[model samples]
Target: MTDKASNSLLAKLGNQLHKNKLVKAGEILLLFIFTYTFIKLIMPLAGDNPLLIQAVVWTANILMLIYVWIGLKLRGESWKDFGLVFGSISLRSAVKVTLLSLLVFVLAIAGFIIGSVIMANITGIPEGANMSGYDYLKGNIWMLIITLAGVYIVSSFGEEVIYRGFLINRISQIGNDSKKATIIAVILSSIIFGLIHYAWGPMGIVQTGFMGLALGISYIKLKKRLWILVLAHAYMDTILMAQLYMASN
Candidate 1:
């Protein structure tokens, strides 16, 4: 029985890989697994009330992944097609992409700072509310390092691959015209990205959604060379992690 089960599983894996459906299945499976891990393990370990936030986060994440996959599949792309989406196809391409990505990171940081300042002034929300946790991390370097690494993996690679790599590529196939398709993809993906953060409240939704638009537009503008955006995203999140660490301590 065990041997038969193993064979069956291997067959399924082979089919997914050969058919290039691996990304679709992987995206779904990863989201589910992470959500499960967050609620069942991370929450308890961190002393967070998983019931208050994690359940909602899981639902949003799963739905978004499903939606993106359906859209991509409908557009006739196999998961293998996503391989070329990350960076440039050549060394020159890599250099150009890296520079562009760095520029975007700097701009995003500026935008976040400006937006936070404006919001605080207009709504009387404290500028430092978001910075509180960063202070705590400053006092605990090891924990901060671990947390940064975790964010780098989860936020940069996981989120970027699923959203920019998978979702946008799929949506970019919708319209017959490339330009039209790119526009639609950017708008739709950005909106979905924002909606997923509803658990963080209105500010989170807007901030994340805006960032989505920025990333999507950058990707589209770069002709979908994914490497540039991925690096930019990782760096941006790294900065955020650093800030959070500082605030926490």
Candidate 2:
């Protein structure tokens, strides 16, 4: 197919997102999942070049954001439709978001700790997330800086865009914007958010899933303040990276 024809087809599908939200939601979700899983599956082909792998991951993450951006544009909407206002951030709100981020950071930790306890009791297992994915940061300040950048784009910002801003909004649309729809959207989004950490292993999944629950609830309660959630996620990842860096000895 020619580029024009392909764009035409995608435009038609974008239109379906409005006319038939249920089906389109599934399609969007499958594409989202495929994007994540497929990239990870093909990652080994990139060999052991850390910079190359990081670049690929960063590109994939940015592309995911772009996909969301394009989808919104195709529907005659944009990030503004979802309350992501990056402009005009006053210091008062900045301070507020920072303080809230600390609180959310605490809640996230509590969630993981509680989840770890419950999971251990239920399964009699104690293995945690296979964080070896980040083991590359051990004693590597340069890589630490690089991974911190990834935390901002990939884990903190991009995940919020994909999971909260896009997924919650899309799923809620499937419910015709009812309160129940919002509740279900948060729950399902949290579940998917948790599952996405599958590389973390079973205990890791539970831990992250619980963390997702905390973040989802906060997102709703805070009136979908995306920046606050983004900062909160950044705070969590920052501390995690710091710990990893410190463990290098």
Candidate 3:
């Protein structure tokens, strides 16, 4: 990077991450490493009542957002910086969000298909993500309803906030928000998104990684209207859970 570019990058990052470029990059790397390692350490304890441990992990993930919130607060920022505001929800916007969600959902599906094909070629039909984590939803009507609420709070909404809003935006900033920087952030965020689904195994990782890539791209294209991404994610979750529920019948 040129001096001007380097300066720009520093100015954008503007803090702990900004000052120490190496540390900033490593922070991202170390987070995923730590997260997965922590999960692996705890998962074995879930031999029989897996739901207990899964719930603990799920709540931990949800609570993990507090770190981001506190980081923002410490910097005199708020989630508004991450596009979690209720901005002028007019009829036009509702329609726009709906349409954009559909567009992104299509793109995500295409990404998933491509990822699936690639995984198949690499691993001879990759084993899918372990849905046993959610096996409680099978024919459990109350659980389905409760899970819907839980997912909307954690998976559909929270994951987008974590992956697209926080990771992409911060990573892009650390690179000075250049085109290349944005692309790198998107790719890195997508990979991490895939990794978080470690229970899915290799195939799940690749497939979700690609889907995350599509979502990341859509996030940037949509001018970071995070609600759109959340809606799109919700659509996917609804479909998956519906399928799981139906499959039991």
Candidate 4:
């Protein structure tokens, strides 16, 4: 094609991305890839300082959130588009969702326990390997507080927005909004979530993957209402922090 023709094609593609909300998805994906690589490079330099590692993680998530916010603006979308509307969901509905989420959380923990037991029997993995990530926060009161705040603010919000709201929606578009496409997106996103927690070892991967699946399913059931997922995740992490604190003491 001629130069002008090629330029026109590029313009059309850009317009398409903006029109379909894929622009934000592409930008976020690129940012995530770059940030992930950068973290891997600098982690050695940061050493085993839990605080530094936590800082790196928070920085990455915050950057992604900013990028996502910008993407939403570029698409002329609001938080409501990502199921963040509080006014539309009634108070009664909110309470019901919260209660149901707690039930789901309990069931998820049970599933994790069963899965861990089965995994141990099948793989012969020792118990302590699964507890690797918890050591950093154990008995560190200040870090524990910071971690709890981070889990609720950074982790719960950032993860739900990126993996569920953005990824599932954008990826499903690739399959032309088919049910199979959505299922694929949920599974793919959940698998990535699990793999990203590799520091927690094999059981961690299994447990996290299971949680991801549960959250993904909930996201779908709730019509992509991220607020519900955020609450659920935050509560789960709060429980974890409490357990960690008790164990350390």
Candidate 5:
């Protein structure tokens, strides 16, 4: 291709990866790495302590707001669009949360069974079949609660805002195919969510993949109302925390 044509192609590709849900998910994965590295770098300056973890988590949450704001600006959506965030009747939201919570609970039980079976078959030890992530939660109940409230809530809602609300909606506009866009967004976001726990070992990947799909499907089915998935996630995490707390003592 000629120089101008090549440059045009590059620009189009950039825009595609920036705007498409599947493509943009890869970009978001890069953000995860960047944020991790930045946290590591800043830890030394701030002292390697619990306060450092809190600072990094809070900074990540703030980044979520910036991500959502940028997405809204790109779509020309005003504060009015945000008002839809609060449009659901209290009863409706309650029903949605209840249903979603049940779905997540069922899926989580199935996941644990599957994980146990796989681990037992592979390792030839039934006792060692438990999930490390669950073990971690059990051992660190208070920390898990803190992490869930501080990071999980922000990350889940931030993800819904950017992936489903903004990227999927924008792609639907470009292609005039809402279903395709939603599917693309959910799958890509789930994959990125799974990858983010690469540091968490194989079990982390498995656990997060299950979680990502559960939340993603919930978002797609609920028409991206956001609050429903947020409540479902929070409820799930809080219950896990509570269970861990009770079991530990």
Candidate 6:
């Protein structure tokens, strides 16, 4: 093709990416996975310090946020477009949604436990697959505190923004926003959410997937208000970390 023709083609592709949520979503997902995978690959060289691991993980979250932010700007969107605004929902409504999300969180935990038990009975636990990061934080108050903050800020806020807010909205658009399409989007996003926790083992994957599903449903039902998911996720992580600390002590 001629130089002018190639330039026109490039411009068309850029415009399509800006106009299509699904394309933007694909770019974001690929970018996140590629960056995170590279980080994980180099983690062995970084040693096994929990603090270092935490830092690396937080870096991945920051990368994800940057990618999403750029994508939103390219599309002429704001964070509020992805349910990142507090003023969009009233305090009373936020409280109601949060309470309901907590209920879902509890049920999700129960379901995950039951699923894990059944899977263990059938196949036994996988080797080297038990929860592995907490040992580093055992009896370390400062590390525990850092971890708590990281989980709330990075895991809860960052993951909710990427998985539930971005993925669900983009994937649903891919399906033309039909009911079935939205449901499929929820499931697909949840599966990816679970896969991202592969270090947690099979049981963890299942549990996280279930939790993601619940969060995705809540996101949709609450009109994409993200505060509920963020609160629920932070509460869940807080409980888990508290339990881990208590067990260690």
Best candidate according to TM-score: 2
Q: Which pairs clash in model 4? A: none
State the C-alpha lDDT per candidate. 0.62, 0.82, 0.81, 0.75, 0.58, 0.77
Local accuracy of candidate 2 as per-residue lDDT tens digits, 10-56: 88877887879776577567667868786788688778765566576
Candidate 5 has a TM-score of 0.63
Per model, how many backbone clashes are there? Answer: 20, 0, 1, 0, 0, 0
The candidates, ranked best first by TM-score, are 2, 3, 6, 4, 5, 1
Q: Give every collision pair in model 2.
A: none
Give the C-alpha miss distance for residue 242 in model 5, angstroms: 2.4
- Badly placed stretches (over 4 Å) of model 3 are 1-23, 26-45
Candidate 6 local lDDT, 79-194, one digit each (tens): 89888775576799768887877876776566556556666776776333356677766677787798898888889899999899888877787777899989999999888888
Per-residue alpha-carbon lDDT of model 4 for 1-249, expressed as tens digits?
999998787676556666655653566478669778878877777677766777787777787778677556655678788887756767999789888777666655664676577667878974633544556777778878878888877888898897788777777877787999999988988877777777788877776777787788778877887887888788878877777776767
> How many Å off is the CA of 166 in candidate 2?
1.0
Clashing pairs in 5: none
Cα lDDT tens digits, model 1, 1-249, are 699997786566545533555444465456546655655554444444433333344444555556555545554554446544433378886678778889877665654555456556777874332333234456677966775665555566557767777767645543433888778878887777776555456566656777787887777666666666668888977776666656544
Q: Which parts of model 1 have CA positions greater than 4 angstroms off?
A: 1-80, 83-94, 110-138, 176-178
Cα displacement (angstroms), candidate 4, residue 63, comes to 1.6
* lDDT ranking, high to low: 2, 3, 6, 4, 1, 5
**How many clashing pairs in candidate 2?**
0
TM-score of 3: 0.85
